[model samples]
Target: MNIRLLAFSFLISASCFSQGEPFRRVNEFYLKGDTRVIGNTILSEHATKVYVRPKGLNDRTEMVYIDIDADSETFSSSNASLDIPEGAKIKYAGLYWAATYPGAKGKQKTRGNRIVYDVKNKRDRPFDLVKLSFPGSNGYTQVQGEVIYDGMRDEIIELKNAAPYVCYSDITDLLVSKNAASGSFTLANVIALEGYMYGGSSAGWMLYLIYEDETEPLQYFTGYHGFSFIKPENTQELSFKNFRAVERGDVKTSVTLAALEGDLILHGDGVSVFKEDTEEYIPLKSRVRYANNFFNSSITINDQKYTDRIPANLNTLGFDLAQVQIPNKNNEVISNDAKQVKLQFKTESDRLFVFFSAFQTEISTDYYQRVVVEGKPDTIIKPAQEKIAEEIQQKETTSQENVQLYGKDGERIVNSRNAALAEMLKVPALRVPGMNSGYYVVNHVFSKRNYALKWKEKMQLKGFSPVRFVNPANNYHYIYLDYSKDPDALYERLLEYRKLKDLKEAWILKVNLD
Candidate 1:
């Protein structure tokens, strides 16, 4: 028996055994509650060419570096533009970058007349730090990112030779501090393998921005990041819930996807959406994306290819970014009342890795109103007989349920609840310079304190005296109606404020000074 052949057979079987699982969800973000009126933008580091594609097999091509910043001293950098509409508020910003790093000391082995690179002794490096330059900045700022998926640390056997990894960072506070709405953004110091590897070498970065636009329809936005190796025989499904479409006929929905190591000429990969009304899956296709070759390396949104990046290669080699609008051409992929969606990705021949996904859908205007007033009493007037009986019953119940209360000084009070309310109304006791150690019934949140103050004044004009509390941690201002040390009392206040039409989406925030 040949020992080498036996070992190679065993390794192939082990790889097959690990090929069917889906991507692990590492981080997720959702815009609900007070931040439901949101929109999103996705910017990638690659450009879409007209008729050019990369040479050789998708996984065996030489990696090309994209450097657009002349002022930076980094080995690799890329720049892209962001255009946020005026009057829109920046709510959340996420930055993600990925690369394939097959260390320097890889060994070559022969398996069935083919040379295979074995990266068994690859050196480890810091894969969680990157440099970022904001719009109109002179120099790059070093940013420590969170490791979303590191194949070296996770030991993903299927992608061991390529050793792909992705990193993510929440740059909301940084962007908000700079007041960066629209401008050229540069990302530098992205580490990746520059030469050929067992699998194809690829590197790219993406910025996903979610903002609040009151002029646009109310939307529910969700974003997820993970790493999954997609093979020919495997299928990956992503499910999104907790949101529903409006009852109108012109509901709009979209999905954004990003992947690595996809071939431009490869075929047989497809994406599908589950239609709730039809009880079947519909293949998603656009003007540039075909039903059988959905993951081809390109950067397209809503049937339009974006060429707004430096060194805009029509073919991204192995990087893919697409934002496809659902129900295009009058296809009822999602119904008016559907609350959930499942997206399926499959390939019959090509192999790729999907790392990020985002979904957005327009919601009803009255959705928050219905949620706020679900259990509230009706405003209709009652008949004389019923009103008289209810008043008598209320008086008797009040007399029986009266309880004495005491203050911090041990002074007796007529009613416990009313005394607490009176003390709260007398002076703003919970108003602290910074975030206090208590629960706050928050009606609104703003990235800038000035904007928070403006909204507070507007609310005050409408018979509301909301207080503003600043969070030093994230530089966000919390505009709240009430606060208390007791969580139950604060929650009750949240419910009461939610009953009002203007404050229908009020929420609660808890802070601990310690």
Candidate 2:
């Protein structure tokens, strides 16, 4: 009986060691001699200035020094706005912003670069590329390349029919290589690219390389997650183990990989050596090798820590699935959407990540699933979006009703008064020297504050108005008012407030006065 039991235990141990995800990834490499520095040949002719980027300890330290040409008065910092001219060397430190709303104050930059991207074209804000894969229920991404810097030399003076084409994200499968001499590169999942990309060990972010005829691979993993290439000498002494647990649905950090037929290994601090799931910590061998056909398998959670005990089949109850909502520019409402190109996950993404490509928001967290489960469709929000759209339409109708041609109120704000002005907006009557009119400023009148004088004063502290008007239907205010006949002044004054406000139901009325 004892001998039979011991044999059965060995079989179970063998089975346990074989169960887990298949190691289907490869290590990408970089070739020597590919980093190119812009030299003096271009500097004397079309070039204005150049940046001497220095190597770094942890991060890079780039020195930007620029000079303008005789034909260009639009130089860096030469304008009061410091709107740098084309080809001017500058460092993108990121954007700066302060909230005009109460209790809202922040400068977002844990991911990087929120600055207004300097560009001549109104349409093309640059974007990073990646390879997108549909992981069963939703889409997962593999980084294609590092940030592609759009240089000034790559611009055109003028074009015909170059209607502002927005730079949007799309899946790419370009041949990424390091040195184009040796054909030592592997086809990567996603390769960042411009026209001709040359990636190497440049002491920068070497994520992935696009493929060309003659290119090589560089470092496999940048800093995300991946297994290291194993040498034959270390195969004997190197330890192998199993059963390290992390969050269930978390993506395995590395994307660019080549699977060694059944011989896959995880390395670094991310090894399956010390398991970190909910249990008494049971450390495994620092590394593990696949036994037989056990390479491609799965680990079922026989038990769970923070939930009720059950028969051990996974379940998701009372969790919000359709939490993501994006602003519908046309409807004036936020809608649950995935990519218009994609089927699902677009709506959930607005709540998941702030501005995609790792720029996260404070409103909600990225979803963490221990197990992937597709739940019932969210029919609730379908009608909700329509209701909000109808409400917005009704509000627009109501606002137009308030539109009267100077009524007894003497140019009183139809929506009442809470106002502030943007740089685009200005005091209209202030444009004319001797214009005698009631140019009262109301501040952020539509703010939740009780439209009190004290609160208005506080609003004024933030460069807003204090005087009151019929507070707009939503959280908006009449920033400026002028019955002046100065067409250019009055017209320009209202331009700032002309953009659609959050309160789509509100309207600007030419108040009817007796």
On TM-score, the leading prediction is 1
- Over 4 Å off, model 1: 1-60, 104-125, 328-331, 372-514
lDDT of 1: 0.59
RMSD of each: 19.1, 29.8
Per-residue lDDT for 500 in model 1? Answer: 66
**lDDT tens digits, residue span 1-514, model 2:** 0000000000011111111111221212121111110000001111233222211110111111112323232111100011112232221111100000111111212335432211222323222332222212122234333321221222432101111111112122211121112111111121111111011000001112222112321111111111111222221011111111111112111111111011111112110111111112221111121222111111111111112111111111100001011222221111111111101111100111001111111110111111112333222122322344465456557754465446575674454333532321332222222323333322233444344433433332322322344433343434332233333333333443333242222223332211
Model 2, residue 262: displacement in angstroms?
A: 11
Give the range of the ten consecutive residues with the poorest summed lDDT in model 1.
1-10
* Tens-digit lDDT track of model 1 for 1-514: 0000000000001112233223333323333321211111111222212224444343444344555566546656766667778767878787888777666334446799997755554545566787888774557888899876666655567566456777888888888887877777778777776544565566677777778776767777666555566666677665776555665456677766655645667677788887653357789889988898776666676688766765555566666666677753332566454567777767787666666666677765455345433634222221322343455456546743254566799887654354444443444334446456776667788997557766765554444546776766577787877667875455555555666667887765656632
Candidate 2 similarity to native, TM-score: 0.15
TM-score of each: 0.62, 0.15
